[model samples]
Target: MKITSVIARQLLDTKTRPLVEVEIRTDTGHVGLGAAPTGSSVGVHEAFVLRDGNPAEYDGLSVHHAVASVTDHIAPALVGAELDLRVLDQKMIDLDGTSDKSKLGSNAIYSTSIALLRASAAAAGVPTYTYVADLMGLPPVSTVPVPSFNMINGGRYGDLTQPFNEFLVMPYKAESIEQAVEKSVKVFKVLDQLLTEKIGHKPQVASSYGYAAPSADPREVLQILAEAVDRAGCSDIMAFALDCASSEMYDKTAHTYELNGRRVSSAELIDYTRQLSEEFPLVFVEDLLDEDDWDGYTQAVAEIPKTIILGDDLIVTNRERLERAVELSAVDGFILKPNQVGTISEALDCYSYGQDRGLLAIPSGRSGGVIDDVVMDLSVGLGVPFQKNGAPRSGERIEKLNFLLRVADSVPHCSMADVSALVKA
Candidate 1:
């Protein structure tokens, strides 16, 4: 099928931030829609999201420039092109000819790339996951990735003083995605009740749809989560994960981290992370160190051998960065965010590289995301071990989780991805 027309427009994300949305129409009457998700604590090396610097609109956060880039440049080049995802994505990359995709904007490019993928899949008369698996040269598998539900928020996403960005619960023991979501939702409700009773009112929801932490101490928040799990009768099936987003707390000049109202060196921070792992049933600690602190990450990975040391900002879904991480053995897994690298093909390449190096892949959603559910298909298609979309609340977050539920019902013999290997001994 050939691309017939392309349209681009500005849209507001979940956080009311401006983002670019692209729609591609094929000659076969298939229309694919996609939008770029922005991050609250973005990595320094991630792809640039173009924003109009005019302060009058959205406080200089408007994506009009991105929308224009898509309409003026991307559409003109791709309107009559083949509907092959790889070919179209490469055409966009070649046209932009920039390492970071600043010419046409990562937001514009990613939105178009994902739209092309969906349009091609629709033309192929197969589900998006099946099409993605075929493109990656993988056999069709009926594995739904374990969902990591972010239950507590801190750092940049919330008003809490805690340095950690997200505290998550993973119902890894659940036999199916439906069971896992049910268990996680129960825990979330229990936590909501507990927080309301403790805080004397309804708790605030953070940017990622997680409840704002009621305490500055990370331990206190974790304890509350543990209590919620116990109350929900999910203690045995649930494991924990943390996204420290440590770069947000790093003091570059002091060579330390401002953690919980105290300054600590890299070694001290690593020690603190290890202590937390020991105190809780933590399966992974993401971005536990600064993005550029390769030595600190290597040290953390070496010291915390049992728990998965996962990198998000550290790698930024870049293949070259992932290769460097493999050389340094800095982390056991990396978060895959498509917009971080500007294209689904690039994200898939990075994921394939990590898999070849024996690293885990966790497809994740950004806090300022739209209601797109392609990430869910990506996870199921790749047979990823886990996926992170915030708590099973809010429309955007629920859309992704609900996609997993639908996939579980549709795929024959589908089962939740095994996470026993990720369980800490």
Candidate 2:
């Protein structure tokens, strides 16, 4: 099968922000759809997203330029191309002729890349996950990732005054994806009730649908989360994770981080993180230091040896950055966001590189996500140890969870990825 046509348009994400959506049609009458998500706390080195600068349009956040890039540049090049995803992606990358995908927005290129993947999968008459696994040169496997459900929100994505961005609960002990999701839902309900009782009403939810915590203190927030897990009878199976997104709090001029209204140096911040891990069941801490602070990350990996020191903004799903991090021993794991690198093939390469070094790769969802559930298939297909979607609320978030549940039911003998060794005592 070969590509017959390509189309692009603008759509609103869950947060009502404009995003690019692409559609590809094959000669065999298979139609595939794709969309790129927007992130609220984007990394400095991630691929660029082009937007129209008209102040009157979506408050200057409209993606009309991206849409035009697809119709004017990408579609014309890809219309008669073969249905191979890598070749199509390379054509778009070469057409852009920029390191960061500035000429043709990452948003545009990524949507098109994903659409091609879906179309090819349809043409091959296979499930998306199976096709993706074949593309990765992996044999068939029925391993689903342990879900990292964000239970509380803070920092830029939340209305709370806390400095941390996300507080997550990972149900690693669950034998199946369905069981893991059930455990998360139970804990989420208990946490909601606890928060509602304490705040004297239904608590407000954050941008990612996690509850907006009432306190600014990270320790206090973790305590409440622990209490909820205990109440749900899931303390034995549940582990906690934090996404500090600390770069948002870092001041380049002073070379210090401001957390909970106090400016602290890198050493001080590491000590604070260590204290949290000691006090709570924190198995993972993401972006605990600034993106540029490789020395601080090395120190964190040394001091917090038990917990997984993961990187998001620090690596941006780029292979070169991941290579440097591996050389410096800066992180134990890395988060995978396909849009961050602008192409599924590149993201898969980065994941493969990290896996070759025995590093964990957690495919994650963005704050400004869409209804697309491609990440779910990617996580299961790659057999990654963990996947991070927000709390089991809202359509966009629930849609991904639903996909996992469906896969577990449909795939015979499928089992959840065992993550017991990664959990810290």
Across residues 1-425, which tens digit of lDDT does each residue of candidate 2 receive? 77899999999988999999999998889988999987999999999989898899999999999999999999999988788998989999999999999999999999999999899889889988999888888878687788888999886434546888899999888767887899899999999999998889998888778998778888889999999999999987888999999998899899998776678999998998899998887879999999999999999999986689999999999999999999999999999999899999999999999999999898998888888668877988887878898888999898998888887778888778888877874
Model 2 vs. true fold: TM:
0.97
Query: How does model 2 fare in lDDT?
Result: 0.89
For each candidate, give its TM-score against the true structure: 0.96, 0.97
Clashes of 1: 0
- Worst 10 contiguous positions by lDDT, candidate 2: 154-163
Off by over 4 Å in 2: 156-160
Best by TM-score: 2
C-alpha lDDT values of all predictions: 0.89, 0.89
Quote the RMSD, in angstroms, for model 2.
1.6
